[model samples]
Target chain A: MTPALAVRGATKRFGAVLALDGVDLAVFPGEVLALLGDNGAGKSTLIKCISGVHRLDSGSIEMGGVAVTMGSPAAARALGIETVYQDLALFDNLDPVANFYAGREIAGPRWLPRGLRLLRRRDMSRATGELLTRLQVGIADPHATVGLMSGGQRQAIAVARAAAFASKVVILDEPTAALGLRESRRVLDLILRLREEGHAVIVISHAMDHVIEIADRAAVLRRGRKVGEMRPTPDNRQAIVSLIVGGDS
Target chain B: MTTGQAERAAPLSPATGTGRTRLAALAQRHGAALVLVLVVLLGSLTFGSSFTGAGNLGAIALDASYLLLVATGMTFVILSGGIDLSVGSVLALSGVLAAYGSRWGTAGAVLLPLAVCGLIGLVNGLLIGRARLAPFVVTLATLLFARGLAFAVTQEGNQVYIIPADLALTRIGQANVLGVGVPVLIALAVFVAAGVVLNRTRFGLRVFAAGNGDGHAAELMGLPVARIRVRVYVLSSLLAGLAGVLIAAQTTSGLPTLGEGRELEAIAAVVIGGTLLTGGAGSLGGTLAGVLLLKVIQNLINQVGTLSSAYQQVVSGTFLVLVVLVQATLARRRRQ
Candidate 1:
């Protein structure tokens, strides 16, 4: 099967700082690729380039074997790339259903027959409910404002939105960094479920356990360059940490 | 670890507490409108014959009708986390243009202001949204520019153009359908349309999202955040222009000084309507109630007849302060 997302020779610079230097990455469908790095290790810059938040200084990205150039975030989304940032980027005043359907509304004309032109509230609610259920999210009401949700539930909703919309790749930046243990586990399970459903997932995380728990392959970054890649099996944590910090395996 | 994982994986209860919370949130969101309605009813009962009288009610509605139009447009601007200080000056300028255009025909009278004021809004939106300028400062500059244009067109406040009597544009401001003033009816229509667009459409969703954050994420989500911002200002200016034309028609003339302080009134109504001045959460219904509530208070003050009409500004200013204080308090509590 084709890799869901591929980045080659990606470089990014902000002012005088070279945030990412000649980084290359590939995320295969049905796989979770964890991007691990310490502070200022260029994880964010790499992901920004992939998600079209920032244009790469020099690099190319391909989605499902097609060369893709992301001029804007919308351009990236058109090619089935979705990013759930650390903030979750949800409207607090709006309910889950509203947030889920924010930009991607199902619209019809006012003069059209009752069900034709208007947003089908019932359909939206039902679809949202089903999506939440599949993710094992504990959101009982799809109409609950996201602001009222706990941090973990909000993360779940964000993840669910990306999974629902993105047909190819989902980039999650520190999804569970702020959550409690129970919530973090739920997010991890959700990540696993995404991979099982044949979506490419790139998880940017600092937590070793989170990476080991859900990631199939781990890529470490140190000082803006890819240090090494390792299979995140149970026994590989120490070696991975050594490579990340000490610079050689 | 496996046992712990199994225990943790046990399906959690789906948001069982969400129903009650949802109801509470709805009430909180609409609380201001409910309060305004109750205050109106109480004021009518307390004022007895004066408040309930048709003449008094009509006067209140008529006065509110134009402000309602301006406020409706401002609602979109404020909801998108931007301000349009130019609305007041735009109102004055549009009124002058409408009066001038009334010489040709009613269509010219109506369409001219819309085109001009909408251009002003479009400029404001482009500068703030696309150029990434601060909304407050950009609109403030436009406000001055619009005011200067108004003064220049009226020859430094020396000219007052009288609208022709036979012009249909005058009828929109003067005539009544079913005993309701046409301006009020138009305002009501605009309000209804605004409410539907804000609550039931994709564009409305994007507005809410843009308001909620720095707008970058919404842009990334394939939303045309800049375009939406531009459209919001255009809608705002169009409404202001419409209201200006109605005012000119009602008076049969346009005064360069007519809408000098109206922007404050419009902003007050929007804020009192339960929209956060900081942006991202507001309603057209709340704004309607807010306009009515302000008008009712002004009407009551007039019925007292002893108090000066200037107290209207004082009362509105006080209400604004109180509502903002309440909002800040609520926001602080939520944060904590």
Candidate 2:
């Protein structure tokens, strides 16, 4: 099958620094592609280009075999691309339902401008409740704001939000970085669920164990280029590490 | 790991502890309303017929009507994690414009000020929102510009443009229904509409999201953060202009210096009403209570007869400080 997202010869530069240089990557639907790199290895730049945070200097991105150009994050979202940044992009003051549907609110009448329309609070709350239940993302009080939530719960909420609208791709930037052991496991399970639901998942992570645990294919970037790609297993785990660190396998 | 994988969702129980916390949150949220009630009761007991009198109460509401308009606009700005220092100046400018425009009839009187003030707000929005400039600095410049423009129109505060006494606009301001000033009734209508817009609309959600202390996050959520910012500033200036029009009608003249320092007063009222100065959470109801509380205290100070009028400022200042302290404490508790 054609990959859900394909990047060809992606090159990005910030001033004089070459962040992503002629990198080619693809991940099919229902697969988790862990993008691994050390500091300044260009993993972030590559994903930023795909997620529409930054434009590629000289490259093209195709979604489901159609070349598409996204000018902003909003444009990317319109094409079913969602990014859950390291910060989770959560409004601490808003409860889970409000947080889940911040911009894409379910409102009515279809005649008024998008801003003036009344919110369909019941519909949104019911949908949020169902989504959270399906993901097993437990918040003790659904009415309470995320400000009082634990790190794991917040991470799950963020992932669940992406899962709700991301029909084509879900890109997670270090989702488990701030989570604890149990929390990290929950987030990993959530990512696996995304894969099971047929999303193209691109995860940027530093944790080798997490990459090995949930990643279907590991793509390593070193010094602005794709160094290697492999199906991460216990047998070749060290070999993947060697690719990332520029050591001989 | 296998056992933990099947984690059960906790039943949402309103435990006694949670109930107590909820009650506390309620108190904190309605703190302004509570204080206003207490003050009203104390005033009624202390001053008897004068404080409890409908005429005095109506006068107090009339005084609050102008500030209420200003603070209503300020609520949107603060809720969106922004500030508009130009509101007072914008108010003055709109008033002068309204009075001068009265020469052309009611349409000219109302629409002219609104159009000009709305354009000024649009400029402020474009500068602060589109240019990504700091709101504080950008609105500060507009504050000076608007104040200067108001004076320029009035010929350096020398000319006081008067609305015709028989004009429809002036009649609306001067006329009362059931012992209430028309300005007070107009302010009440504005508040009701504002409350609905803030609570139940998509724009309201976006405002809160934009104020989430991280505009980037809101932007990533597919929100037009810049547009939201720009619209709020426009709304604020438009409201300020509306207030100026009412004042111009009430007094039958526009004084370029009428609204000096009113921006600070509006800010104080908003903060006292429990809207976080840093943004993200607040209500127009709280702001209403805040405005009323301030005006009521001023009226009470007048009723003292022996006390100096300056004492009004002292009480307002102290109350402002106390309210802020309470809010800060509650916010810290929430964080913890």
Cα deviation of A184 in candidate 1 (Å)?
1.1
Flag regions of model 2 displaced more than 4 Å: B1-24
Q: What C-alpha lDDT do the candidate models reach, one value each?
A: 0.81, 0.87
RMSD of each: 6.4, 5.2
In terms of lDDT, the poorest run of 10 residues in model 1 chain B is B5-14
lDDT of 2 by residue, B1-336 (tens): 011100101001111116555555565567888999999999999899999888888889899999999999999899888999999999999999999999999899999999999998899889977899988999999999999999999999888888999999999989999999999999889877877677677887788889988587897787999999999999999999999999999999888997998998899899888888888877777788888999999999999999999998899999999988887776676566
Residue-level lDDT tens digits of model 1 in A1-249: 778999998898899999999998999999999999888999988988888789999989988888999888778887898899888877776778777777777777657653234555566778888998888888745544577678988999999999998898999999989999999999999989999898999999888888988899999988899989999987988888987786554
Q: Local error of candidate 2 at A41, Å?
A: 1.1
Q: Candidate 1 regions off by >4 Å?
A: A109-117, B1-28
Candidate maximizing TM-score: 2
The CAPRI classification for model 1 reads as acceptable
**lDDT of candidate 2?**
0.87
